[model samples]
Target chain A: MKPLDKIQSIAAYLDEDAVDTDIIFPARFLLLMDKKGLGGHAFHERRRVKKGETPFILDRPPFDTAEILVAGKDFGTGSSREQAVWALADLGLRCIIAETFGEIFYANCFKNGVLPIRLDADTLARVRQAAGREEEIVVDLPSQTIVLTGDETISYDVDAYRKEALLLGLDEIAVILRDSGKDIKAFEEGQSRRAPWLRLGPDKWKVFDDLEKEQFIE
Target chain B: MHAHDRPRTLYQKVWDDHVVSTYQDGTQLIYVDRHLVQEVSSPQAFVGLDAAGRDLHRPEAHMAVADHAVPTTERTATLREGLAASQVARLSTNAARHHIPYVPMTDRRHGIVHVIGPELGFTLPGAVLVCGDSHTCTHGAFGAVAFGIGASECECVFATQVLRQSRQKSMRIRLEGVCPEGVQVKDVILAVIARIGVGGGVGHAMEFAGSAVRAMTMEQRMTLCNMAVEAGSRIGLVAPDETTFAYLKGRPLAPTDTEWDAAVANWRELASDSDAVFDQEFEIDVSSLSPFITWGTTPEESAPISGRVPDPAAIDDPRVRRRVERSLRYMALEPNTPLSGIAIDRVFIGSCTNGRIEDLRSAAAVVAGRKVHPRVQAMVVPGSASVRLQAEAEGLDRIFSEAGFDWRHSGCSMCVGMNDDRLLEGERCASTSNRNFEGRQGRGGRTHLMSPAMAAAAAVSGHLADVRDLWPEGTK
Candidate 1:
């Protein structure tokens, strides 16, 4: 994970609302565990004609070097596929500005060290317009502003806790375990005392594990 | 808070009970009741665990099943080629090493992670169920607060048998009437999605209530909760009742009669207190509902079977008009076209939503005395091996086969399209699964979400037609 303070780069564009993960990475490639290099297959149906071909958006000049992505409303609205976020990250996209995002997908961006910033329609349109003109676009997450060239800055919003987590390069697990070790221990101790049957030791666990593989016979 | 102010929703009680600790910043660590794992998501989490040099915290907390990677074809036993095979292999290796309970394909209960949770009696009321898959909300039918997590959260849950989440706002959708003749729970959910847009229920846990939902069977209840995710809600629930207890009794994982009575006594208190206050409420007159089929990419883009495709000109919002235009282009459909007469390329009658025996019975009734149209390709996949066996025992397989439907094994066959089964380019399909999103079934495949009976009717007619007109006499 990496802290995302500020990003200044050419921005790519995708203007379709509800741009689902199915199109972002497609289910065909979902079986691949490694998230690196998935950017090449991002938008497989929309951007590619055949193998070794860069089709519509990615084939453009400045977008090829984009570090920020500007998309329409409800971006990443389908399956909880983190591969889409990984694809953008692998392609060096640190910031994605959209009108709205799918709930799970929005949460995923924070976990993976990517920023999903919700911009109003007017702001989204202005950003996309700026990208079309090849103007330098800067997103300062810590500052909570989208900085364009010529001193124009637009305020942005993020979950307060999430913003702090991103600024500190912290994962949710790290944050939870840091302060809750005592609480969890107490809870576990109480649970064991109350429900002794649930405290399955390794010896007792094997009895249940074997039952999991019980086969069907005709 | 005063005594009069203490009627908490089920969401509140379950959420409060599960919280291990809360921080000053409103970040809470909640204990996970069940962690359902599949091949597609678990492999990445396993890779993360190895990279971090961390072992699984609690093997007993996890349930691993190779579902998404396996195909539903007659030829089972081995996985198909490509990442599907390798991913399943990774899951097996990881599960074996961690000593977690792995549901093998040979196991009769091996099925979609959501289906198997209840079938095996692992999903209980007043618990929290988490999975990497979005449809994990399906498990909420048993009164659990279930929701999907990303691969990163999966890894977190793998390393620690708990998850960190803020509480979601609570909502209730009350349906007050018996379903009209020929209407199924699938139709009810589709109509509900149509009324409330895809984002209507966002950031809320919707509780389905009223007399209609109370009358539903356990399987039908699962069907309704399954699509709550598609409506932009992570969790949907029905209060635990006698039906729930009866369905869960005598299962391999369920407790004995004495233990069950005690558990039920606690679960009885998990329901929303009378006069409970919800953040939002929506009521539906279920008797007025009709069979619905999605006409476009979004689940909200739907109309009843007798209705017509919506015209962009009729839309008031410009952004909505733009989305509908793009959807129409991808679907190759024209505005104002009668939904009933549109021809379909295929029919898929299975998935976590509509793959239970009740769904099979409904589809079987439609195909019993009719032959599938020669031009249409129809497939019937059970949700689990046990479901398949039950279908076979009741002769549903023969009816499907005789009517030109390909009867197949269970495992998320054509719904999300990860494995061998998928639709070709420019194909139009009537699917009994959730999500009508573009390329959901395959590349360039158009899906029309419908009920099992509607899909069966489409297969027999070679087009989208009203099931009421095609309903055979004496059918349930």
Candidate 2:
């Protein structure tokens, strides 16, 4: 995983709030069984383009170079449908800059390696203006600076843990595993001592023991 | 202690009792007593189990229902909506495979999961329940700590039988004086949401109490709690009272005979102690509230029937101003438009929120001698088969039919667009359902959330009309 030093691109701009999961990826396409081709229908309901649209959001000029989505308040408000996050991630949107986001949607973005950035109204207006002018908007994660093509810039901050997670591509489970490294071995030893029912037989035991032995050797 | 300090509301008591363990990170592991599952989110849980070769940890504590994706029409063969049919069938299959009790669409117990939980006595007082559906807060009317959980969290509960959660502070909303005629529990909740704004109750549990709430029926209490989520609260509760005990007396899973007497005795003690403390308190004068209607996209963006649509400029807060403007555009309403004269194309009076027998009865009473507007499409769907049967037995269904409304089978019909029942694009509807978000009913469909009686009045008048005017003599 690469640490995000600066976001130099202003990929695309969505104008509305509460863009629900149902519209993001309709339930009809849930039958796809795989995540492939989902990007084609990212904003199917609202997309003005016809079917067989080329390059999807990437086909649009200024949006093609934009790595961030500047959106309205309460962006992604309804439903806990994770497919919304998947579709956006598949579209290669690295970050979303909005005034506010739904609690579940914000959490899902972090889980899927999308940095959700919150900015004040004046900053949002500047980005919106830049988007209208087809100008490039740059966001520097480390410096917390968002610069427009007109030489104007604004600073914003994100939570430290969320910043680390996005930079390392670490999800909640990954964070938990990282924090529980020592606890895992202690838990395994305690389970073997007190509740051996949790332990596996010889064939499975070999796999576990081999891993434990490798850890000891390391 | 202040008046708000009495027993700290039911929300506080239930939330405090469910704390399992506090984590070093400030989150707490709250024990879930009953977990309701559905097909939409449970497939991932089963896949997770299959990957780990792990059996269900507490199958007995969990129950499944097919409601969200179930087709409401009477088609026996293939359904017009293939995805919905398959989702319903998958729920049945998964519940059977896991040995969890399931109420399929063909079963007598079939209905919205939230409605069935309380009807079957699964949502007992002081229990902590969770469902994949957001309206799970409906169970809190039974004095239980209930809220919605995400799919991954659902899997965690299935494996460990406990959910990790942080404790929330409590808010007590006290209603003084008797409820004025024509005003219902819906008006009380809507008024509270409008006053507090949508995020006022964030990170807190709300307990509804006082003279007004105490006088309400169990079904009405359920309606009040059902919209707690719209206020951004995790749970809403009313203390178990005589009305609550009476409603649960002959329920299928409720205690019987001597056990019933003992249970009532115990339930009576579930009220808050006189000296209990709550973090915040709000009071509303019930007499002042009238029949309410949501004119905008959000539930909190609502006003009384006689009031005019709010001007966005009048709202000083930028977020609220933006919401007001956006809602007006989606609803196609002018800033100063009177709510009374706004015409509607359809009327829907059903959902887990307000589709119970009491709700049906209230609507039926309004439409009994009236005729539905010829241009309007009106529907009344019962919450459950039991409610349907009860309405039919009392000829309430006939009253609806006589007024030219379609009285259909029980399901989450028209509340969400998943099923065949949906509002046409660009058509405005007066609905008794909880959400009024844009396109919630269907693509380009407009929804105005209201009470069942108000929906009934709108069906007859073909516009947003006050139900109080229909019953000048008041709820007799």
The candidate maximizing lDDT is 1
**Candidate 1 TM-score, true structure as reference:** 0.95
Off by over 4 Å in 2: A1-43, A49-59, A64-68, A93-100, A106-218, B1-9, B78-81, B255-277, B310-322, B472-476
In model 1, which regions exceed 4 Å deviation? A49-55, A193-218, B1-5, B75-77
Worst 10 residues of 2 chain A by lDDT: A209-218
After superposing all C-alphas onto the true structure, candidate 1 shows an RMSD in angstroms of 2.9
Which tens-of-lDDT digit does each residue in A53-162 have in candidate 1? 77577667878888888999778876888898888788788888998888898998998788999988987899999988788998888789988877889999887888
lDDT per residue (tens digit) for residues B345-429 in model 1:
9999999999999999999998888999998999998999889999999999999999999999889978989888899999999
Say which candidate scores most in DockQ: 1
Q: How many residue pairs clash in each candidate?
A: 0, 5
lDDT of each structure? 0.85, 0.73
